[model samples]
Target chain A: MTLALTLDNASVLIFALTGALAASRAQLDVVGFIFFAALTAVGGGTLRDLLLDRDPVFWIADATPLAIATGAAVLVFFTAHLVESRLKWLIWLDAAALAIAVAAGVSVARSMEVGTGVVLVMGVATGTFGGLMRDVVANEVPLVLKQGELYVTAAVAGAGAALIASLLADGTIWTTVACIATTFGLRAGSLLFGWRLPVYKPRPPRA
Target chain B: MTLALTLDNASVLIFALTGALAASRAQLDVVGFIFFAALTAVGGGTLRDLLLDRDPVFWIADATPLAIATGAAVLVFFTAHLVESRLKWLIWLDAAALAIAVAAGVSVARSMEVGTGVVLVMGVATGTFGGLMRDVVANEVPLVLKQGELYVTAAVAGAGAALIASLLADGTIWTTVACIATTFGLRAGSLLFGWRLPVYKPRPPRA
Candidate 1:
């Protein structure tokens, strides 16, 4: 498989695991596990593809990623009992998935020769949308919208790094490496240290 | 505007109103009102357009619908206090929006010469996805996924009707009319009669 395809499938697998872990925490049935897992694995990329007008979608054209997502979801469903502190594992898995997703998204956009703005946006969307969808379906506030997390910022930095590297480098491998490293590094830093962005504080309503 | 555009705009307006009302109930600020409203109004159509590979999403290409949605949200934000029982109004508005959205979705797919199955899926997605997004953002279980609602089924029936009509008739007017009538009629009937589909009952977990 191509490097991009490999990165995409890896992202899908990890995201699917996170989704299934979420469903397990919510005590959702088997169907819900599968649905949420698949949704989280592909939701971001699906939105990006749609926005870019990529027909047949990446997964529809190559079902391998989807198969991996579904298979991972099922395995998580059966093996969740074996994992201790699933939430902690979920966070780490999600961070890794986010990095891979950002790399894959940036790679696709750069290859398509889309404008810089669109490429950056696609990268972030691909990295974050799936987790947002998973949280929403699980009836939790999306982590991206939560205060004091460097989630989207990390994606933006990673995507920007990818875009810059693509312009300077001869091949895409360097671009992917830069994108993944920036995203995963930022995310890991936030997880280990309490890194945060400035949050909006709502003013008290008038009497 | 053409009939399809009219239907799309109408859907956007009402869905935006419902989204704004939801934000009002959630005690969100003005920014939330606009965000939720725009998300609800265009969410479904955006997904459908993306899946169909239509470039420059309908609202993106023509800013009128987005303008209407944002305008309506702002208007509701200012005047929400004047309305009695916002939830009551929200339900009625959502039903109307669902019908219009279904019609618009079916119309687009039929015009694109897509298959009957795809047309139906797109119609349902267009009708229901906006509300789903709104509810998810509002941290409520999506009304469509809730037990016993005929929400999605209504869209399916309407889209199917449109597809059959499109095959038999010459103009899209007939297809649009059929779609709107079936969807609205079913939704209204459910409201008036408490009509519902069979609910899924989860089994108790083994000890």
Candidate 2:
């Protein structure tokens, strides 16, 4: 439980930073920054909890995550302009957050003792939906949907790895480590080595 | 409860139609149309239920709404090309849905015996957030957030009217009627007579 809480907080802070950076790029006001930050930080987990019928939601149950996100937004609001490459920073931080969040999702779902399919779906949803919401609100083409992007694929792979690890190992820590390493490794490879999946190409209509 | 269920179903069908129209404009596939339709139909109420800590969200409790949305999506996917002005149809249908949805939200919140402020927030959220999700997913600027549009304003007015009517009258029917009339009337006025709120304009920075 402590590990899950720590992972959730870390991901919330990192995702909030990315959201605030996006707000700065959009030239939104301070309120907009806070709104985006909080939304991005909590969006994925909120969806998970709602679908799983977890009452009160994470942020509502404990306000610390909300406070952390708000603080991150304020911090970024003042210092974003000082960053040399906000986009680069945003991308890397988002990748890191995604890995941590997926692990957190797996941890939560495992604790709940749901089936493997739901656990995997929750992991991917938690890792990707926050960034998806952020991009949609900011009016950017969602990175998850970008042609042949490895974002969702990476999340799925990581979650699968965690499940596999759980079958072979006995501890939550090993599963979590497996999940984060696989997610971040694939995402980082895509960024640095130009790793990609084949994009769909339209074929000519039938004659 | 039956009245609330009827209103919820009505709004879900109308919102799903609008979502399908959006998918048509985006030139997405049949699956995409269904996805958009279901998301828009459930997005707002899901958010409200999560916030209110309602167990097993409405659609999960009753799958009829999901089936209705899917049926609407398939219908629109085949017939949307025949509509000469999809955008016009979408706007009017959305307004009707918004009014019905607000009434439903108010009814549900009131039944739960929540405070007035929460009731008002839920009403607006249930009215506007569905279309907001539709627009965001379609990558179109959200009609609710469009410059000076009376969309959210209309919802607020409608919710306020419901509360005021409750104070003055004795029945749920009266409050629901007041809410719908005020919301649709304001929205129709905005469409027909150019009703709008003042929008924010950036001023030059200090010289």
Candidate 3:
């Protein structure tokens, strides 16, 4: 559990720091930055656990992630002069978070023996939902709804890969590797190609 | 269930329209306003039902609420000039929704036979959590977390009143009235008196 928690906690810090940078960009107060960091850290998993009947949620059960988030938020707020403009860093940081969170969500859901469909949805949720909530809270339109290759679409592919791998292989390690590779590959491809769903357009009205 | 659906559908529009008003006050676009309205409408009950293991979620079980919210959102955006400024009317409208939501929460929880403490918590969740989410999404500190004697406090008092009444008397019209009145009275009093909890100040640093 300690080893596993290390993976999850590392992901939490990465996500929280990104959130703190965003708050600094917005010029929010220290308290506001802490709020944003904490929200980014736990918002998605909390939503998933609440929906899936997982109680004593991760944040509630392990307070370390939250404490670390608070610390990071405070540090960033006080030391804004130390870092460069976060625009470039924020994008890649968000991308890394999306990757790790998708993997973590798949692992958690798989441990519970949730079905493949649920796992896929949960993975996307774990990856994207926190950032979505953060964007909304920060008063920005969600990028996924605008010019992005399917955000959740790639996550679904990744989880599906893991599910299929588990059936074909003998070990959890192979299954996890397959899923992560598939999702990351698909997401990168989509990003490179600007692949997107066809825009909905209504036929012109008859004259 | 049909009758309940009809009533709920009507209320969803009312709540969303009011929420749209609130969102517009923050200068959000139509999409943002619609998102805010949806959250304000279902966010509270979703938390309660998920906690209580209620299936299919009330809004998802019937698409009526979603449709109503979307339609109301569209109307508000196109014809915002036709209506009063949303901020001016937000308090009373939010109060009314809170009154209705708290009563609905207590009744539903009691029907499910949830224990008193959990039931009271659910009531507060149903009545006030959505507004808290709304504030966060609007980039404001949540009013509930402030020192204000506001919505959550009223919901707790009202839920307590409902529990006591339901235990002592038959499930009559009076029970509903008592619950509603208690919440309304408490909220109104808080508003009128500018009631608030004392701000927390850290004690002087120790030597």
Candidate 4:
């Protein structure tokens, strides 16, 4: 449980950094940075908790995550310009956050003993929805939905890896490691090596 | 309770229509229409429920709203082009939905006996977040955040009216009527006469 909580907090902080970077790119005020940071930090987990009917969402139950997100936002608001490539930083941080968050989501759902399909969905949602909300709110196309990008696909594969490991292995640790490794590996490959799935192309209408 | 349920369903249907209209304008597929319709129909209430920690969210407890939204989407998918001005129809339908939804939110929160401030927040959230999600997902600047628009202001004022009416009147019916009247009146004025609140403008940084 402690490990899960730590992972969750780490993901929140990392995602908040990405959100703040996006806000800086948009040239928003300090309050906007904090708002975006907190929203992106909690959005996915909130959605998951709501869907799972978990009581008093994580941030509401324990204010640490919110505080961390706020602190991250303030730090970024002052230092974002020092980063020469905010977009590159945002994408890499987002990838790392996605890996950790997917593991956390899988842990939560497996502990709850939900169906595998729901677990997979929750894991992917937890991994991607925060960034999706941040980008959408910032008026940029959601990174998860960008043509040929492997964001959601990587999340799904990672969650699937965790599920398989859970069935094959004896403990939660192995499952979590599997999830993070697969998620981060795929996302990193996509960023570093331009790995991508084929995008859909419209065909001519039937004659 | 029946009255509240009816109002909720009505708002869901109207909101779904507006969402479907948005999808049509975006030129998305039929599936996209259904997704947007259901999303807009339930987004606000879902957020309100999550915040209030309402068990078994409204749509989860009662699938009727989801069904109604899906039906609205299918109907609009076939007939949207028949409307000469989809934007005009979307805005008017959205305004009506906003009023009904605000009343429903106030009713739910009041029934829970929460504090007035939380009730008001729930009211505005339940009225506006659905359309906000719809616009965001469609990659359109959210109507609520449009420059000086009375959208959110109308919802807030309407919710505030309900609170005042609740203090003065003896029944929920009076509060509901006041909410709907104020919300619709302000929104209509905004559309018809360009009524708006002053927007914030940034000052130049000091030398």
Candidate 5:
């Protein structure tokens, strides 16, 4: 398999696992785990494709990702109790998946020759949307929009890096490496060191 | 403009109002209100389009619905307090919007010459997805999936009616009326008198 496809598959697996973990934490049924897992694995790419007016959507065109995601969900469902803390692991897994997904998204958009703005938007959307959907489905506030953490920023930076790298002479490999590294590194740092964006404190009600 | 377009626009307005109400209740800022409103207004149609592989997604092709949603959001942001209770009105508005959205979705799918199953699924997705996204973004369980509600059932019945009506000779008007009546009647009934599906009670953990 090509490096891009390999990374994409890995991201799908990680994302599906995170989704299943969330489902387990929510005490959802087996169907719920599979549904959420598939949703999380494909939701972002689906959105990106729809927005770009891409036909057949990624998952519908190739069912392999769907199969992989469903299998991962089943495995996670059976082994959830063995994992001491599901939510924590889910977050970490999502972080790893986000990096790879962002790179994939940026690559797709870049290949389409869309403008930089569109490419950057697609990349961030591809990375963060799955987790956002997962959190929404699992009934938690989306971590990307929360007061704590720098998740979307990481995605933005990675997407931007990819876009910039694509302009370089030796851009493809560098774009992939930069996008993944920047996103994963920032997200992992946040998990390890509690990195956060400044809270948006509303001004006191006018007297 | 076509009847479908008119109904779609009306749905967008109502859905946007509901989304803005949810944002207000969540104490989100102006940007949040607009963001959530657009997401709620377009979420369902976007999903349906992607699943059906329809080009231009709907809101993207014509910016009017988007403009309407954003305007509604801003208006709600400024005048939320005038509504007495946002959540109560939001639910009722959502019910009305859902019926119209379902009809529009069914019409689109029928025009595409897709199968009954695909049409029905698209209709339900169009009807309920906006509300689901709104609730999720507002950090509440999606009311469509929640127990003690006939939300999805209403959508299914409406979509089914539309599909059945379409098979009849000279069925366009009948299809629209049937779709609207089935969905609105059920939803309004649910609001006026507590109509709900059987709750799923889990068996206690195995010994």
Candidate 6:
């Protein structure tokens, strides 16, 4: 097994955990939680594959991610209370997951030589949109649309960093790692400090 | 407008209405209902386009479907009770929507000369998956998944019928119409006679 494969699997686990956490909070049954977990874990990759016109959609092609996601969901079902007990650590874990997803998406897109803009947008989408879909499916307002800690903005910035690294370095592993670190650091800081975006308000009525 | 264009636009309107109807039944706000309408209407086509690697993703390329969906959503918001108040008639209208969507999807798949298996799946997907997505997004159990009429099954059958019809004919308008009729008739019969798949009950506990 390689570092990339390890990170990929970890990313899938993180993705599954997000859904499992949300589902457990919603008090869904095991089946429901697993369904949401599966959707959250592979939903973005599936969309990416479909948009890329690739066959067998990645999750369907390799069952590893699905297996991991199902396992994560089951684990969360039994141990949700334990994880919830550690409320302070949850934000950092979420930030880690978001950063990893962004980095992974950027890596794959650049490897495929997709255009810069597509790469950036798709990376942000892959990182944040799965959770967005998860929240939407779970009947909650999407975090991206709300006044959250600039989660998607962080993803976009991370994606930009990855793109720059890819363009500058001659396929060096350090470059990729550096980009991932940049994204992860930004997200972790935002989460720890409760950072937020400026709110948009309607203009005052004319006299 | 060309016949193909008419069929395409009609399919969009029908599916959009189906989504609007579902959202209304859920008592979603106007914006929420409009979102559901657009998702239910264009979601299948958008997925299809993505799978085929078609650029602009359909709705983003053509403003007509989006505009049409918005208009339909507005119309449904004002007249939702008109449909929701009558459960039976609305079911038939939804069936009609399924019919049109299946027909349109089959026609487009033929134009692409996609593989038979993928085409069949895509046709059914284009017909009913949007509604499934809407139900998931609206945080409700999908009607098709419950003890309801065979919606997706009928859609698949209709799509298969259209493919076969296209093969037998010159992809004539009659073939499409016949396919649509097959879908609608089957769904209508299901509604009128309570035709449904057998429920999967848990096996009796071993003695």
Q: Give the CA lDDT, 0 to 100, for residue A157 in model 3.
A: 68
User: lDDT value for candidate 6?
Assistant: 0.70
* Candidate 5 structure quality by residue, lDDT tens digits, A62-163: 898999999999999899899877878988889999999999888777766455656776787788788888987677878755544667768878988887
Report per-candidate DockQ.
0.11, 0.12, 0.07, 0.11, 0.13, 0.07
Q: Where's the lowest-lDDT run of ten residues in candidate 4 chain B?
A: B198-207
lDDT of 1 by residue, B107-151 (tens): 786678565656676788799899998997797777655445567
| Chain B TM, per prediction | 0.92, 0.95, 0.84, 0.95, 0.92, 0.87
Native contacts retained per candidate? 0.12, 0.13, 0.04, 0.10, 0.15, 0.04
TM per prediction? 0.61, 0.62, 0.58, 0.62, 0.63, 0.58
Residues A67-131 of candidate 2: C-alpha lDDT, one tens digit per residue: 88879988987777666778899999999999999988887888886999999999999888999
Which regions of candidate 2 fall more than 4 Å away from where they truly are? Answer: A197-207, B1-43, B50-128, B137-139, B143-207
What candidate 6 gets wrong by more than 4 Å, as runs, is: A1-7, A85-91, A146-148, A195-207, B1-20, B23-129, B136-207
Evaluate residue B176 in candidate 2 and report its C-alpha lDDT on the 0 to 100 scale: 89
Q: How does each model score on lDDT?
A: 0.83, 0.85, 0.70, 0.85, 0.81, 0.70
Tell me what TM-score chain A of model 4 achieves.
0.95
Instruction: At residue A118, give the lDDT of candidate 5.
Output: 62
RMSD of 4: 6.8
Cα lDDT tens digits, model 2, B143-177, are: 75454456777887899999999999947589889
lDDT of 1: 0.83
Quote the positional error of residue A38 for candidate 3 in Å. 10
Clashes by residue pair, model 4: none
| CA error at residue A12 for candidate 6, angstroms | 1.6
